[model samples]
Target: MHYCQSCETPVAMEPRNGHAVCPECGRADDVAAPGPLFVVTGASGSGKTAVLAGLARRLQGRCVTFDADLLMDAAGALSGSRPIDWPAFRDAWLAVAHGVAQSGMPTVLLGPFIPTHLQELPARRWIGDIHFIVLDCPDELRRARINARPPWRSRDIEEQVEFGQWLRRNIADRVDTSSELQKTPRRPSPHGSTAI
Candidate 1:
């Protein structure tokens, strides 16, 4: 198992190319708000979805959240047979998230966030504070979650094996997702005033 430089998650070394994509969270790592981005990246069973769901509830109005899949349709449009003007979609959404971040709001982006393909976000001009988060869990537990997924929903075991290894190697700051899945890693929220 090796860790991905971009996502920082342990994954298996085989079949590692066709899918550099993370099953837990996607390109939210590209967010560059200078402030905490309230990220949630991890392996499928790492409790990424569960943690984010809780985080969203915990931070209700203080955060503006978006799932990585929120732009999947638009991303797909970029390769449409007719090329459905996806550049416009990309620019639009990027601008929206950046705008929201700029509004002094603590924002959370949770989903299958991959960091490699997507460039770092919000252009140099949009700089602010930035922090990162990655959730973690034991391999057996991860496999169980994958298995619990509906017949059509879960990723193949082989694929998850590779990804699981990858995530283990990459993550440094992690919150283990056991039954308690302790909120042991409560991050300093990006909202509120900064000391001058």
Candidate 2:
């Protein structure tokens, strides 16, 4: 039997409307399909890139990193010389990520975004339940990691650290990356239900 890609609840042979409704949360799993998308957002040097890289390697899937900056570049006019459009950038990020999830591959998105980016998406798109993994840690430690990175790495660790802290405070259920926190969540139940 087929199943909901997001939560794994069994689905009828002909699931309605190309959408998979999760029997557990009453939430639509993925409107399109499953790609095991994991979004890891954090200030630079929060170890998100490293952690996601490790996860990608371990999973044996080609790690795809979708930086919204690319979208900004695609729309250089709106993105401007600074590459900062919080609202538009966030919208684009959610769209690309949701599509990636539908592609049925493993994906890891690293960015600096607030929780509302996902929380505010339209539920009908069934864009909800995209695994959000926030990377957080003491600002100082994060700063150190950033400084240790190659010259190409971000140098404004303080600003990013501030943002990360703000997100960590505002968002509920962020797995702390300060130390060695597990990245992957336990698998959902057979019927596509989350215990939480």
Candidate 3:
């Protein structure tokens, strides 16, 4: 599930001369075997970055752990007031995760993503089951966490609070991040299936 950066269109798995070329922009890249995609999502300051750091340490040799935001620079320009194509950004990440999974290691991606963002994308077929784990904490605590971040990382407090509330209400698989992240239980097996 690749997205053509030039055309801003979803790229499907079709080969031309044994190479996967974007029908929309003629962009080319290699396609790899598919594997499950696990998304660790939450609002800003929900400890996603922290949790990813810990999870990466634990799952280092077992699976691939990545911060989805690392691709922000490649996804699109963020200097102006132009509206970002969030879905396209998400699809691009999915494609990357799929590529990484070809090594037989499932990818655990951390970002402000929800199941709705990736479940229905054409790239969804590139992976096996998609699992979503929402990280949440109380609104007041979340505000404090966000407030403590560096000025460059600051976000709209109200918006993040609302987004956190919405995730708790909609997602069943959640990790209460108000407490120490180390206290969080062991994650699902990273081999192929995620119990959560």
- Using all chains and alpha carbons, the TM-scores for the candidates as numbered come to 0.58, 0.55, 0.73
Residue runs of model 2 more than 4 Å from their true location after superposition? 1-37, 61-83, 105-107, 121-126, 149-154, 172-196
Q: What is the TM-score ranking, best to worst?
A: 3, 1, 2
1-196 per-residue lDDT for model 3 (tens digits): 4455566555564445434577776777655466788888899768876677679999989889988767666544552456557777777777777777767789898888878788877666677778888999999988877676555554688988999999999989999888795455433223221111
Give the CA lDDT, 0 to 100, for residue 46 in model 1: 65
- The residue ranges of model 1 lying beyond 4 angstroms of the native Cα positions read 1-36, 81-94, 114-127, 181-196
Q: Please give the lDDT score for candidate 1.
A: 0.51
Clashes of each: 30, 4, 0
Looking at candidate 3, what is the lDDT of residue 110? 86
Error of 3 at 194 (Å): 28
Report each candidate's C-alpha RMSD, comma-separated, in the order given.
Answer: 16.1, 12.3, 8.5
Pairs that clash in candidate 2 = 7-192, 8-192, 9-191, 9-192
Report the number of the highest-TM-score candidate: 3
lDDT: worst 10-residue window of model 1:
187-196
Lowest summed lDDT across 10 adjacent residues in model 2 is found at 187-196
The global Cα lDDT (0 to 1) of model 3 is 0.73
lDDT of 2 at 59: 59
| Cα shift from native, residue 186, model 1 (Å) | 23
